[model samples]
Target chain A: MNSVLTIDSAIVDAIVAHARRDHPDEACGVVAGAIGSDLPTRHIAMDNAARSMTFYEFDSMEHLRVWREMDDSDEEPVVIYHSHTATEAYPSRTDVSFAGEPGAHYLLVSTREPDSEEIRSFRIVDGVVTEEKVNIVDATVDA
Target chain B: MAIEVRVPTILRSYTGGSKIVEGAGDTLSGLLDDLDAKHSGLKGRLITPEGGLHRFVNIYVNDEDVRFLGALDAKLNDGDSITILPAVAGGALGFAAAAAFFGR
Candidate 1:
């Protein structure tokens, strides 16, 4: 797997917007791309079933629908993102223990600061968390 | 009765990279046992040592969550389809807080 996440700047903006909108409650979603393709193209914002400021869970039925859609489209969840309402942009013990997608980029957005946000990404596999670089590319610019 | 079971990416290792595997049983628990016989250790991943569904693993029978269908006791048919998915969950809560909240 690549050591960095190269995502569109627009998707970053959308994720930040989602975090801000959910504010005290954690927001969660996924960015899907073609299977085996590290590139993320589709941003899907999911409901936080827990709806707690300190926790987030994708609704089960929604997760099923999203997974089915991705299966039909030959896409995989390239990025799985959630917000930390009162902490830094890092995966906590809970996140590590529940990290099931070995190939996904686990993105954490911290909305603790009222005026600014912190964004970071990591690859969590087998209970190991390895931080990765996030490369935001301009949509209109050529890669 | 042959039933098709869809394995998620993480659990694909247990299925030997096979996305879909076939098993036969009259109930969800029995079906898991049947698959475990061929796949080896696959059943432990879905069911805990206490014989309950793992908290983070989700199993569905024909699009309906097995939790609502008597979980392990859920009845199965000859051609029913089963899909297994790991729950997508986490939080900013620290280990202690998370354990307390989840009753773990």
Candidate 2:
């Protein structure tokens, strides 16, 4: 049995496109969807906060809500995605120390360099982190 | 085998777009020094001019982050992989937690 990562091109693209769309500053949001086993990864959209774009801080309740929805749907929180407008695509100390959520993959999109798409993914657990490749596929969302 | 330091996209320009680099050092700081030798500005980005890893940047030895260990001095095995991650996500949940607590 292989644990292959399934991601929608539309989903990851929407996130990366959001970052590129709002270039020169960080763009971020939570990916709400069921993870694994033929789930559409659907009804998934980027949640925008009015606070700021240069940086994003997920709302705990929102975070909890997403997790609960995934659980209720028999899904797992697959990935946590973010963009770096001015910095590299690695996990910052804040990212590692404050992950709070385990087993979920962290995806970083780089928008600092324009005219090209720069994105990377990682699996972080118990402070031991490993890199994973992003597989983008076109996904159909259930409205 | 050498410890492979995975470079993030934001810091790649320092290494001329080189993503992975090898170091023969046994400590995280030593690896940084080796990287700095090849890419000078990298050290400035990861650490302050004062030689401290910026609050936003983190170095991980294999799966164990150096911060929880000895930080820069954290020991590494021959096959360890060091990952550099930067924190720049939006809507950090910290403020949200405070708002929820005070019902603000």
Candidate 3:
């Protein structure tokens, strides 16, 4: 697997918007893509069941439905994202412990600053966190 | 007594890369035991050492969370479909303390 996340700029904007919109409360969501494609094509904003500024958990039922839909579509969550309202864009101890999807890109968006945002991505597997490069490409450009 | 169990990507290693597997039991706990017999270590990932459901793992029976249905004692029908998913949870806060506070 490549150690970089090449996603559409539009998706990145949407994610940032979601994070900012839900500021003061952690926002979480998933970007799914065709299985083994390593390309994120769909953005799904999910509810933070915890709804706490310090924590985020996807609503269990919503998680089930989205996961089932992905299964039916032969897709996987390429990017699992959550915002940190007060901290930097890095995985915390809690995030690492719950990093179950080894193949996914764990994207962290820190909305700590009102006028700016910090975005980073990582791969957490077996309790190890490896930061990866994020390559935002224009959607209108063909690869 | 055939129940179809849908395995998540992370847990598919135990299922030999098969997304769906079959098991038999009258209760959710019994079904997990049955699966462990075949998959070996599968139950360990879903159930904690204390035999309770792992907080990070979520098991649903026919779209209903087993946690609300007596957890391990939840009844299972022959045609019931079981879906195992790792809960997507975390935060910037100290999770050890957060977990204790939330009783998760």
Candidate 4:
């Protein structure tokens, strides 16, 4: 049981914003950052993986964008993130089955509670998903 | 130092689909309790009655693994974050290893 972890404000904000924007269904995206201490979590895009049912799709184009951003910044892809509109904040069989040996952290956002933010983060090696406690540090991002 | 907790897609079912959650504590175990209180179903699913993590789950205080750092008792702080990940197995990509290391 590890103690605490850190995630980027932009990523967190992006996830929250998307979930709020598309309620009643799940929204998904990718995060790219250098791995080491605190791998920054940033959202690159959103999708209707299962517009009919409740599913998500991580856009490959956005992934390229984030990958390029990391490249320009001299950072490597470190994490991938997604949201569950009406599901638990934990990983599912689908997620595990599709999870490529990404060699980075896999972050998930929860939106079932609605009353309070059930946002949580975790790491998945192979198919096993491990939950990580996130400690948020507000950064200055000029809009 | 504050530990940043990373949220995954599955557990988002409990968070209303929020991607991040923050907490404070002095150990991985304590931090989980705090997190479970703040969010929901975090502790029950992650921790087992054996007083250790669910085995399928892995927690890290910073980059150091909780099992290596202090296990459930790993220390934490106001800014520290915890990541909850589960084992995803049953695939051709070393499914056994994934299940052995993670879960099926």
Judge candidate 2 at residue A34 and give its lDDT: 54
In model 2, the runs with Cα more than 4 Å from the true position are: A1-4, A32-40, A43-54, A139-143, B1-104
The TM-score obtained for chain B by all candidates, in the order given, is: 0.92, 0.77, 0.95, 0.73
Cα lDDT tens digits for candidate 3, B77-104: 9899999999899999887776774454
- The worst-scoring run of ten residues by lDDT in candidate 4 chain B lies at B86-95
TM-score of each: 0.96, 0.49, 0.96, 0.49
What does the interface RMSD come to for each candidate? 0.9, 10.9, 0.8, 11.3
Model 1 alpha-carbon drift over 4 Å, by segment:
A140-143, B99-104
Error of 1 at B50 (Å): 1.0
Q: Once model 2 is optimally superposed onto the true structure by TM-score, how far is the C-alpha of residue B99 displaced, in angstroms?
A: 17
Q: Give the DockQ-based CAPRI class for model 3.
A: high
Docking tier of model 4: it is: incorrect
lDDT of 4 at A134: 78
lDDT of 4 by residue, A37-98 (tens): 34554445545534422455433333334444665676654556566666666777666765
Q: Native contacts recovered, in order, as a fraction for each? A: 0.82, 0.13, 0.77, 0.01
Q: Scored by CA lDDT, what does every candidate get?
A: 0.92, 0.61, 0.92, 0.58
Mind giving the per-residue lDDT tens digits that candidate 4 earns over B1-104? Answer: 45567765456666777767776667777677777887878687677776667654555555455666667767677776565554321211233443443421
iRMSD of prediction 3: 0.8
Q: Write candidate 2's Cα lDDT for B37-102 as tens digits.
A: 988878887776666666545566665557677877787779888777553233223444423432
Candidate 1 lDDT over B15-72, as tens digits, reads 8899999999999999999999999999999988989888778899998989899999
Better of 1 and 2 by DockQ: 1
lDDT of 2 by residue, A10-119 (tens): 77767777788766655665554554453336434344343344455544334435544665776755567777676778776545554534545677777767776677
